[model samples]
Target: MNLQRRAVRQNVEKSRFELPVDGEVALADYVLRDGVMLFTHTETPPALQGRGIASALIEGALLSARQQGLKVRASCSFVVDYLARHPEFADLQG
Candidate 1:
């Protein structure tokens, strides 16, 4: 499945990037301040875990931050780990 499509809807009003699963939603939460997007958490429903939903959620959230010209602060351990693994996103780090 195209995770990109799953994460296409970013609900900034809710401060999260969302992916609809089988009637559930996986989300990456964030806080935006001082030109930086602080990724705080990522979550997938128990049934939706292990399906790359969190990865897609975080990817979409980071991409949105990049497009908006915001730096990123990885406050969440998952995000910090993901950033460490994906060096291409290094440019987004604040």
Candidate 2:
């Protein structure tokens, strides 16, 4: 679905980053504390699983964190695994 080109939007009131896909929304929930962004969960619709949507969402979130000069605490398992696999973002880990 060329997810890499898709944009993720942050919903500040909800404390989540969202990516829209095929009438559904993929989201990564988080809490900002001090200077850290703690990622708590990530979800993609059942019909959208295994489509790289979650990964794209996380990538966008991490990129946004970097731009905002925020550290990251990846409590979500998916985010932990993603950070492990993408060392380029290692500097953002808090």
Candidate 3:
């Protein structure tokens, strides 16, 4: 899948980044404080797991954080792992 082309929706009211795929919603939960975005959790429907949905969701969230000029604190293990693999986003880590 072209992760970059995926459309992610940010539900500011819920403090979550959402990616809708095949009728399922993959999401990453976060908390923003002091100009930092702390990713607390991520979930993908059981049927949608292993399809790179979570990765796409995280990438989108990271992109959004960058656009907002916010630093990142990845408390979610998946996000930590993702950041480890993608150094392009390392500069945004706080």
Cα lDDT tens digits for candidate 3, 1-94: 5643258989999999999888889899999999999999999999889877888888888999999999999889999999999999999999
Top candidate when judged by lDDT against the true structure: 2
TM-score of each: 0.89, 0.94, 0.94
| Backbone clashes (count) for model 2 | 0
lDDT of 1 by residue, 1-94 (tens): 4655544577879987788878898888889899998989888899988877777777777777888999999778989998998898999999
Please give the distance, in angstroms, between residue 48's alpha carbon in candidate 2 and its true position after superposition.
0.7
| RMSD per model, one decimal | 1.5, 1.4, 1.3
Estimate candidate 1's alpha-carbon lDDT, on a 0 to 1 scale.
0.83
Flag the better candidate by lDDT, 2 or 3.
2
Between prediction 1 and prediction 3, the one with superior lDDT is 3
- Writing each residue's lDDT as its tens digit, candidate 2 over 1-94 gives 3455257999999999999888899999999999999999999899889888898999999999999999999889999999999999999998
Q: Residue 27: error of model 3 in Å?
A: 0.5
